[model samples]
Target: MFGPASSRSRSAWRPRPAPAARPGGVSPRSARRASGSEVRTPGSPPAGPAPRPALPRAAPPRAERTMPQLDSGGGGAGGGDDLGAPDELLAFQDEGEEQDDKSRDSAAGPERDLAELKSSLVNESEGAAGGAGVPGAGAGARGEAEVGAEVSAGPRPAPLARPPPPVPGWPRPALPVPWGTHPSDPSCPGPRAPRPSHPLWISPQALGREHASQRLFPDKLPESLEDGLKAPECASGMYKDTVYSAFNLLMHYPPPSGAGQHPQPQPPLHNKASQPAHSVPQLSPLYEHFSSPHPTPAPADISQKQGVHRPLQTPDLSGFYSLTSGSMGQLPHTVSWPSPPLYPLSPSCGYRQHFPAPTAAPGAPYPRFTHPSLMLGSGVPGHPAAIPHPAIVPPSGKQELQPYDRSLKTQAESKAEKEAKKPTIKKPLNAFMLYMKEMRAKVIAECTLKESAAINQILGRRWHALSREEQAKYYELARKERQLHMQLYPGWSARDNYGKKKRRSREKHQESNTGGKRNAFGTYPEKAAAPAQFLPMTVL
Candidate 1:
């Protein structure tokens, strides 16, 4: 039984070994039974029953066998590769890379966006400020649109209205006058009636004879004249000359009362013999001077007596010769009469009488007065002797007198001298200058007193304590003050003098204090300067 048990144990162990082969391959008994004989082929190991096809790997649990999509696509390569990497881990790593890339992209994008935003904002700001269109609008396109719109709107305004052109060959139209009822009246004209060529109108009185006589002849009439008409010499032939002369004479010598009372009668022509002797043919003195013809004088005696010897009755003379009865005894009866000499009359006697003889020959022009009567005589009638009558003959016979013009010159010179010697009128003073002068006096007095006090303090009882140069400086300062005061109050000399005296006294005292310190040249030594370091940089 022991032997069989041992054999059985060996069989059991062999079987155990055989069972182990089952893992490697099918069991030998099963292989022999299946293959008919456990035959070995040449050069090859005996193949037992197909080694029980690897248990089909139990189809690896469905989830464990499937790898993530990454493993299939070249994800797992080496031993140390992340094959065990969880899907979440791989996804997390991928997500982390994506996040990093996104972060970089976000940062870069923000920068790019910020730059773009900044550029856009800058463009928008420029556009708003410049009144241009939005930034993206092309510049050339926008300008063209603006120009096209402006041109399409309207034509440009004209510069200004041109003045209406002047009418050809004609003046501006006359303003229309309103028509009245009277159509044919000259005063209510469409165009004003042409002004009369001679518009002057004369009054009836101005055309009368007495008015004419007064203007043409201002002096006394010739003694034997039949009628007083203007002398032929006085006629001004030219129209303008006549008008001017007539107007001037009318203005200067106005018509007298009753001058134009009667209309002048027409003149009749006279035979030569019928004409008055006093109207003997004469040439005007003016014509005689201009013409070559010599004037023939009338017989001297006949011409002299012609107008002068009017028949005077003795009774008319006796009326002016009345004398007092008591003065008759004093009158002498026999008056010596000088006899007339027989010599020929001198040529000078021609102008000696009250009237001059007519110098022109018969039928010549009438004579003009050498001096006009109005110019000769004073207008006053009475007191003729006091103011020299024009007819009075001077003893010397020469008409002009030396002292005549001298009187006006003497009077004017005297008046001018009197005016020159007159005292000057004082200008009126206002309160301001007076007040200013008073204030200036007070200031100057106070200043002088203060200066004296200062000098006195500096000198103490010893009045000559200061050096000459210091005295000069003090006096100069005082002088300047006085001068300033005088300038401020222009005419205040008294105050200025007082200040000057005070300054002078201070100067004298200073000179005395600096007792003649002599240098080698025998003059006072110059004063030494005080130490510069000790002095203040700025003066008070």
Candidate 2:
């Protein structure tokens, strides 16, 4: 009871005809043609001359064919056809000739076409060298030299010289110019020195965007300038010495040449701030002590007697001698002074000006400061007017101590107080802890495990199983977190969080409770849905 479909399936299976009998001993499948005089079946009459076998067409000449790429030793076993052969340079040279032919029809000028061809050839040479950096540059230069020599030596007539067409937007790639080479004749066909290639063409809009971004975020400074900017103290100290030396010269005036007698007691000032800056004030009694010949113990001796190891810093008294006509021997025995200047100012009868005086009308002097944070008082931090003496010697000397207030604080003390007020920073998670935090819930969902200990064990195995590249992500995240933590709390340390009580886990707290009031059902009302759990500091 075969249906129509079954009958059609049976008809579809037809016997394949026996492979056409091999005609005249020739393979039926091969492209070879039989003789023109085809033989008929043995006993039958021969048919009219069989259509003449068509002859195979000849291949085009190699010169007219496109050249194949040369193998640059980078080819593998599969690239047997790419192996470079003799006259390979001719292939590249021919390619340039082809470009020359196209350039004849193009709107571009001959010089530009020639330059482009030269650059293309040079880039090819560099590519063949596997990006050999400096050596590749040399190869490109040599390729350009060969191209120039070929153009000059060949019998082909030169292309008529014409000015290059103007490029309105993005310009064509420029030829490589060696370091220190003159740009006056870039197009001249001469052997150029080695240099890196110009970057590939970029859209004018992209270049403009890049330039705008550069203006917004300026490029990083050179290593030398960067180091100087980072350590401002060193630069400030240098300028401080210069200004300090100038002030020392202006403030110090040696007494008349004799022992024990002091300069006429300076006129007392009503208010120094009220005096016009143009009119020099009399030397303050503070610096007057510096001019005195009293033999006070050197700071070194005083610090030693007190068992302190502080480095001794004496006032630079060399500038004082420049204002006086005296020798070092006439000064106090215990005084330590700096070496005399190479060009000392002539002993001035009146006053010497180290720099031009300000022309601004009488007003307060411009406030001088290093760190703005240090401008907490009216007196400058390092100004000589604020100190009792140029040198900080112990109170053992006859000079009376100045009045002091215990309330005023120093910059260091203020900074400490601010830091004490800041809230403490929590420790950042490590790579493993971060990984567990992210994957712990996922693992719990998949494994149906409520116990965190079991879930963590699974995550630990998964963490180890992860490829190095995958784990590196967590490591990088952890590193960035630590960096942010350091910036937020520079003085924070792990020890600060140590020995502190940790909050009890929800499960632990539930177990600790005796029991919660049960609903009508004889069970503790599913302990008031415990509040959201806190993240654990450690993996377990």
Candidate 3:
């Protein structure tokens, strides 16, 4: 009678047996019998029986006993109690019906919901994958959203396409090159090659710009002449041309018409309005003193003013006449003849007829008297106004001859007087004779004094009693003095004829005094003569 359905029902409701004993050897059944349960019955099934025993009084199955343990372990004590109660059994049956209803609802809608969830998960994964490629995905999404909003308001334009990736080995887009510059790439436009820095033409533009920026603000500009010409903002092409034109005009053109000329008129005087208030007129002390209202000048002022006019200086008339006169103590005179008788009216004489009067007109005397022609003229005689003849006349009461005529007469008289006086006087003594006379006298006096002194010294020396050495020294000193005097004044050794005569006379007298005796030195007795001394002895 164990149909599949009934068996399933019984299995579900069965109580569990006690745990089997472990391998160590205790039996749970025996333990249970010992704890006051029945141990055995006469028709009980064996322990190893294939079929289970029949229930007593229709009790629940043994498996049903394990349900509380399972429920308690899985759920709690309340779950164990619920598993044992009939009401819980009914609630569980209702719970099963509710679960069936939920399963049915899930089955009915699961295909569309699962598909929607799978699509959302796929979109998230793809967006995350795209995040690796895009640099700012969130920002891009925000931008897209904004663009969508714009589109909703009106038709949207397409986003601009990104530029193509830079090609390898190709040059990147170069910055704009300045004028006269070549790009890093040789083929680029402008200059064909990079220019080396030129020493002479080196540009100061960069350095100048830096200096200009530091020194000049918006209002003030550089004051340098070059800077003004080169300023980029100035009128184009005008600066260089204007400067060159100015230079050329300065170099080539004539100076301005009024240049270096005196000014035509004085500058207009400044009016009171034109003058600054702080300026005051400055008057020099001299000007102020002169302009003051003083009636009389001071003595110092008069003296200062006197310096303006100096006395006129006159030439020396005596010195002028002396210089003009040809001979000493003479002056020239001229006389006009009626026309020299036989040599009548030569052309030169006719020329003299028209000559201006020698004295000039009464109001205008001749400027100078010493004319060359007037000094050469010959003149008439006897008239008081005429030039006197050299042979003249009366001693008394005669007017003095003209200076030139008088000079001639004086020269003739001087010659006559000189010839007449010449025979009366004897010839004059010459310098050589005078010199001989003077020298002879001097030599005689000196020789006499020196000879006397030597004699006295020799006699006084006690010659008979003296040693040879003492006598020799005295003699040597005398000899040296004589030699020195002769060397120093060679002119004193009188050698002329007069000197010789005087010496001879002295020698004769000396011979007489010595009675014609010759001394041991084979010389006559020495005459008294002075010791010779050098002239101009002060220097020594």
Candidate 4:
């Protein structure tokens, strides 16, 4: 059982009597205050708790400090001594701070001097050109020195405050303005026009980066092998048959070297090294003249068949016949062979000269030229055999058609040649095409249109509306593509890709000639289109 407040509980809760007062009737608190007044030798720290290291707090006004009066003479030795005591104690108390202040002042001495010099110069110029008009004035020098001394004695400008240390979780405040600007300056030319850049031309194949732009497309102009293979257009294949035909014609039967230069007639194609050994079943006699190494003379009975011939003379067999081949005995004393037919010379070569041919033996066939180089002519320069042969001959003074070969190569051969040729190089995209490639998808998304026709129409209008500089960018890109294409295919020509025309069949040709039905009026009739009539409807 616990006791009541008046009993043992009261004794337990009651405060103990205060400790007996110390000697001299002074309490602990009063003793502590008096301890500060006790003097200690300089350099030794104060007793008891060490003073907190002083922070750079602003000092009080100088007027508050009790200084020695100038008017009052030294009253007594004790008073004089005490007058300096307070000041000495204050200086000793802030010794560390004073040293710090001295160090900062020393560090900023040059900058402060420069600022003071500039200010003084500006002030002097504005107020009155101080001693400037005088030829030699020591007054200006004295003034400058005095101003400098005053400025140095005064407080130096506080160094610019640094940014506060970054807190762990908070974002940093905007960094201080660039060094050349003033504090809190907002107009620091923070926004600058972007520098213009020019793109370097690099082929798509050369690029190592794999991105959306480099993807292959069948309908798009090719930029790489993959793109080329993807493309469905084959320009080279379409033109291959025609181009090869023309090329073969030129190669097999080239024009004479010097047709009109000399009075001597040119040799026949039968003499050329390029002439074929055997005749093609489809080639006419005209074509056979170019292909056959040794062609048979035309029959003498046919008046339409004409040829060039020389007087009966011993044929030069020096290059063709070797003594070991036993061709010397077989050489005809006079060989009458049908040479290449003659035609009028060009306007530059004066007038036409007809060298009538003598009737030749129809069964005789000329020997093939033995050496390829000798095909040009005999060893002699001015010899008749030295003259180059004309590949073809026009009908003499008549526009009548002559029998000629339809095609040098068969359908199967042409098809095979086309299949064997390399894939054609794709044409480079133009400015508009390039622009469309880049912006088509963007437009499709914005317009929500999937149809290419509609998208292309919109893109085309936008392309025309683009600024000159914007369009120029695409043009430059296209130019770079073309340049790269040229570098890749130096020998390629646009003419090679010219498409071939389809040959008309005999039945189609007849149909084209008699295409429309004719009446007794002797005129073919054309159907007239009916005019449309818009029906009017009333709106409800």
lDDT of 3 by residue, 334-384 (tens): 001111231123332221221223332234223444321122112321111
RMSD of each: 71.2, 38.1, 77.4, 50.7
Q: Kindly list the per-residue Cα lDDT of model 1 for residues 1-540, writing each as its tens digit.
A: 111233322332121211111232333322322232212111112332221111111112112211112232133243221211222112111333334323433432322222122112111100111212212111222122111111111211110001011101011111111111112321111111221111111111111111122111111223222011211111111111111111111111111111222122111111111111110111111122222122322111112322211111111011111122332222111110001121012221111120123332234344333321122222221211121211112222222323233234354457756443221111112112212211221221222222222212211211111112212222222222222222222232232123222233333323343443212222211122212221111110
Scanning candidate 1 in windows of ten residues, the lowest lDDT window is 167-176
The estimated TM-scores of all candidates read 0.11, 0.17, 0.10, 0.18
Q: Candidate 2 — which pairs collide?
A: none
Per-residue C-alpha lDDT of model 4 across residues 86-126, encoded as one tens digit per residue: 22111111233333323433432322232222112111111
Give per-residue CA lDDT, model 2, range 15-89, as digits (tens): 112211221111211111111111111111122111110001011112222222222212314332111111121
* Backbone-clash count (model 2): 0
> Relative to the unseen true structure, what is the Cα RMSD of model 4?
50.7
Please give the range of 10 consecutive residues that has the lowest summed lDDT in model 3.
275-284
